[model samples]
Target: MHVTDACGRGGATPPSRWDPAEPDPVAGLLATARRRLGMDLCWFSRLIGGAQVIEACDGDAAAFGVHPGSTVHHPGPHRSHALAERPLPVVGRIRPEAVTSGTATEATGTAATGVEATGGPLAGRPEVGSYIGVPVTLADGRPYGMLCCLSRDADVAMPARKTRSLALLAEVLSASISDRRSGGEYREAAWWRIWRLIDSGGPTMVFQPVFDLPSLDCVGAEALARFPPGSGGAERWFADAAAVGLGPALELSAIRSALRAFTCLPPEFGLGVNASPATILSGRLADAIADIPADRLVVEVTEGDRVEDYPSVRCALGVLRREGVRIAVDDVGAGYASLHHLVQLQPDFIKMDQCLTRRIDADPARRALAAALVHFAQETGSLVLAEGVETARELGVLIGTGVHQAQGHYLAPPGPLPLPASANRTRPPDTA
Candidate 1:
């Protein structure tokens, strides 16, 4: 929360913000409701494959002209301002207004977290469920949004208990976001609720200074998202996100948070962000990058967990490429299967993972791996990036291998990055 509330004694509610929604009624009610609905997207648009859906979205999805949902997205008049006009940042949940119907039938065991939208570019988009969002706030309220579950099913109306529960959640959500007492407020807190811990003016960002190997000049910046509050460290906060099924949500929030900080960066530098394959598959990536200048951004696909669907991941990456976002295969040599993904993706940049970069001057095996990755990148006309260059000797070896870029503590540790006074004026040596 960005607001400054005067006279403390704010209050407490036992983290029990609100009760969760109850299940919806049985199948008969759902079927009847779904049948009553008129003209859905599939019915309105001509039958085309996912490609056609993509074509429609690319052509005109925003106008709601491209495709209609199985049910109307805005059933009646636009009622968003009601929930949206608050100060809390809506994180894990959807907007209250977007609530359509809740299910009492059975839990599909799927999460409410945003997912890869399906079909075209619009497919696998984050937030597929019916929902609405609005921000709530305390005094110095930094307005946030709410993600409320409108309806459990696309066609059904949510039960009264569910709506009431969601509404209760909305209220607590507002308070949780607005309650920014001190650094220790987030320990053991719900991960999504951790948004309240967002530092002043929202979350802060540090741009890892990236040096072009041959030129040894600052050519780009990798945006590293870090929260200032320590109620829980980065690992804890990140862990919470995964627990609440909001890994992608947090990642997207971090990217947007990074972008807000990016405005201060020197315009010439390309901005890079660590992106996960999970997010790419969910599909709102294009929507996320739609506002950013494609020429100035590089989305490094850092694989965590595992690459479940390479084809889908590749397809999403291809779209990003088509849109001009540079792709980088991060941690190239750390994973045994990395090379295969690298070869398949044919990324614009291949970052030598820190495992291989650390102590490379003394390790023959690491050096060999580095050499092989560099050779592959060069052969494919892709630039090589060497991260974790913590020593002069290590840097020397990287320069010798003809690696294209380097970043690490020796050059710069991840800090509130704007090229500190020591770094802003300094330049990398011209190894070429």
Candidate 2:
């Protein structure tokens, strides 16, 4: 996808794949994200749609890591109305924190005058007096983008306009984030805002239905986190934590939240929690590891974030695994490292990324990856859990592949905990 530079200028040339005038494909991709979270919802907003990558903050955004041909989209007073329909207004890119804080509904100006984000684009535009916008989030708790409204010479936030309308619009904004993952780009900003809430501990947990192939019954859960509006948001929670090198702290806190949230859950239910390599590889994780009840943990390792050394990470993982902690190489096939890691660390679990899991029924390549992952996990004595299962056909393929468990919307959205258990239930003890 495209990322805007700090100056709001796209530079000498625009992105090859992106036409700022037509971000629908990107928007459509974003709309497809289905967040079934227990805490505040995890956004896949277009930010999640195509999603944003934190550049190293070197050179232009493209050098940082923006996708090919993608340039940032600007929403000015002239372009403000466009947001009414599209919602997520991509700006020239900035720091991840700026993305989060900017997307939240912090009014730019007080009602002293009738304006939304005062001194904003609309302010300079003729007859513009008000503005409004919401941030989007990604599945991993990053800002996606935003949707907003503006009223020329009118108070957009005026209390007299049947405040409930604003309430309805807020609800609409909320729903849009959930809906956008499937096809809307506008929700990207909202998704980010949601993350900021989670980062702040506003988001809680939900356990979703995960199935076991042998039993053909529900077994474990994907530990999903959610955030509510007015919360600190995932950005502040995770990004700031990252900036200060406290990812492990946030992760530990999230695990505690899950423990409290899932305490009543049956022993058979396992919760999948997101983790970063930095958190995993950090020497300090011993204490964090000690805090997690060994029985309840199903750590999913997402590679999208930083991980300096693989061998050391594997050793750290070994330490946890030795303690009866079940380990998972999450999002395999979604990035570059899993295979090397799979060979080096040989985790107790392998969560095939949804990109590979999505069309397995129709695509042979996906099926092969599923099969290979299953074989690798089996050889390593690790369980295979395919994440983001969205289709019955995909489920059937997973079963055919001999995966130990499955998670995704095909069964149900990630939501509140304590799903019922049966003989086929996920074996928490088995994880160790």
TM accuracy, model 2: 0.49
TM-score of each: 0.53, 0.49
Angstrom error of the Cα, residue 363, model 2: value is 0.9
The Cα error of candidate 1 at residue 156, in Å, is: 54
Tell me the tens digit of each residue's lDDT in model 1 across 1-432. Answer: 223212121212223332234222212322332233221121111112211112111112342222433222211111232234322221123332322221111112222222112323233233233432222333354333222222222423423444344345445544544453321234226633654543223345677889877556877678876766655566666666654445665666677777664567677788888777777776767877877778788988876557767888899988888899999988887785566669777899998889999888889998888889888877898998998887777888998988989888777777665654233325455343
| RMSD of each candidate relative to the true structure | 19.6, 19.9
For model 2, residues 289-373, the per-residue Cα lDDT tens digits are 5655676577777664645577788888777777777778877887777766666666778878889888788899888888888
Least well predicted 10-residue stretch by lDDT in candidate 1: 50-59
Best by TM-score: 1
- Per-residue error at 161 for model 1, in Å? 46
Error of 2 at 106 (Å): 49
